[model samples]
Target: MPNIQVSALAPSTQVIRFNRPHARNALSLALLQETATALHAAQNDDSVRVVVLTGDDKAFCAGADIKEMSNTGIPMWGQSERLLAWKTLENFPKPLIAAVEGYALGGGCEMTLLCDIVIAGQNARFGLPEVKIGAFPGDGGTQRLPRAIGKSRAMWMIMTGSLIDGPKACDWGLATEITPAGGALARACEIAQTIGDMSPIAVRMIKEEVLMTYTKSLDESLSLERKLLLWQTHDHNEGIAAFLEKRRPVFSGR
Candidate 1:
């Protein structure tokens, strides 16, 4: 079977599942390549409006496959293909949500940071335990974790190599919500459906603008938002008219 499985949850929502359950869905090079391929395919498929990334009940992902790394003697971060795969996720224009259960450590935690939203199960455990193994998170964990959960908490996780439960993750702002064990994927899919029902143009633009806020100055961010607001497409007009007419608006993604 494929290490990664891509399936349609709804007409507009696509799910990418990490299928290496025995290894706790570790991020091997093959899995990364497959994930990138699935993501690119979803990006180009007009029928797919939102993407949900998840793994099986046992684990979201344990992190990079240490055995593979030791055997190959290769660094994932320095590898061009792996870096490109991550970049593909970073540049994806559509909405991306992470459905996290069990372990999300090191590279696994970094993967969640790439998503626009994170829904974690009650059994989830998040950490950057690379330090314990004499390594550190090289896959956006150092940068994104600080931005998401603030400097102190991110520093604590990185330095201590300690794990936090799902509730604490939600409190720390790492997770948007916490569900019962094994419910994260369902919750994420539900949210994805709602997002898919909205204007695709607006959704994409909103995601772009939100991510842009991380690096842009306040004035620059506002300027960009204003520009997007003015570039309102047919969907925007339809939305306004639909509100006025008290009817559902059909968006063509124009």
Candidate 2:
């Protein structure tokens, strides 16, 4: 079987599963390329409204494939593919959810942090132990972790090479929710479905607006919001009308 598997959980939600249990679903170069390809496809497909990332066996991911790294000496092409995966996850317009269980370490943790939301199983453990190996988190972990979990916590994780359990991860804001054992994937899919049921244009706009907070000026931000809502499409009108009627809005995604 392929190292990665893709399936549709619902008409509007796609699930990507890492299947290399022997390596603890480590981020091998092949896995990185496939993940980027999958994300690119899902981003372009209107049918795929939400993307859920999960893994087989007990590990969400064990970070880089150490054996491969030891043999290949970190090929430049491999590094580029990995970076592409990181960017794809980080910039994905649709909702991205990580269902993390077992261990999410180093690059694994970086991958989870890129998701718009993270749901962890009770047994999940997260860390960035790059320093232990005389390296640093190069796959955007240094930049994104501080933004997600704050400077102090990210510093502690990176500097000490310490790992945090699921509960601590949630408390530190690294994970949005914590579920019972083996429930992370289910919860992620549920969250995805909830988001998928919303108006597609509004969902995309919301993502755009949230991403703008990091770099855009106040004027530019406000202008984009105004411009996005000015579409005045049938779906936009339906959203307003449903809100006025005081009932759940059924979005046709026009």
Candidate 3:
């Protein structure tokens, strides 16, 4: 059976679900490759403005596949398809959202952190348990965790390998929203639809600029935002014209 499932929840939103529920959707090398391929397809499709990643009701992802990892070593240890898949995840240009329900541990937690928006079911569980396994989270966990939660909190979680629930995840800023159990996916789709209703160019630039905050200085980022607003964006012109005309803006994504 296929390891990943893709569906169109909306004209502009693509939902990718991890299908390995028996394993709590543990991210195996093959599963990651399938996910990467799906992401690449979504990235190339102009009609796909937002992507929502999720898993079955049992779990968003348990972590790396234990059987595979124990036998083969780390999944993304070096230059390989796994590493490239991670790179694709980190560099996805459009907005990506995560709808986390159950376990999102270790590499799974890191993947959630990679998303632009994270919606979690109140019963969702998140952690970095690799330290207990005599390994550390290697797939953006150390870096992204600190960025999501504060340094000290991230340090505590990483060092102790403790799990946090959805409410706590939101309180610590790791999750963007907390929904009732089983409502995360629905809420994420709702948010994605709202984003889809916006101008595609605006949505893409907003994602790009927000991600730039990590690599660029505030002044540099501001300057870049200003340049785009003044000269590079066609949507802004349409927005202003529509406001003056008292009509809805029809964006061409130019």
In model 2, which range of ten residues has the least summed lDDT? Answer: 69-78
Per-residue CA lDDT of model 3 for 164-219, tens digit only, reads 99999999999998999999999999999999878998888888988889999999
Global lDDT of each candidate:
0.93, 0.86, 0.90
- Compare candidates 1 and 3 on TM-score and give the better one: 1
lDDT of 2 by residue, 91-190 (tens): 7888889999999998889888778889999999999998987888878789989998899988999999999999999998999989998999989999
TM-score of each: 0.97, 0.91, 0.95
Score candidate 3 by lDDT: 0.90
Which should have the higher TM-score, number 2 or number 3? 3
Model 3: how large is the Cα RMSD against the reference?
1.5
Instruction: Give per-model CA RMSD.
Output: 1.2, 2.1, 1.5
What's the CA error at residue 188 for candidate 1, in Å? Answer: 0.6
lDDT for model 2 comes to: 0.86
Q: Write the residue-wise lDDT of candidate 1 on 82-139 in tens digits.
A: 9999999889999999999999988999999999999999999999999998988999
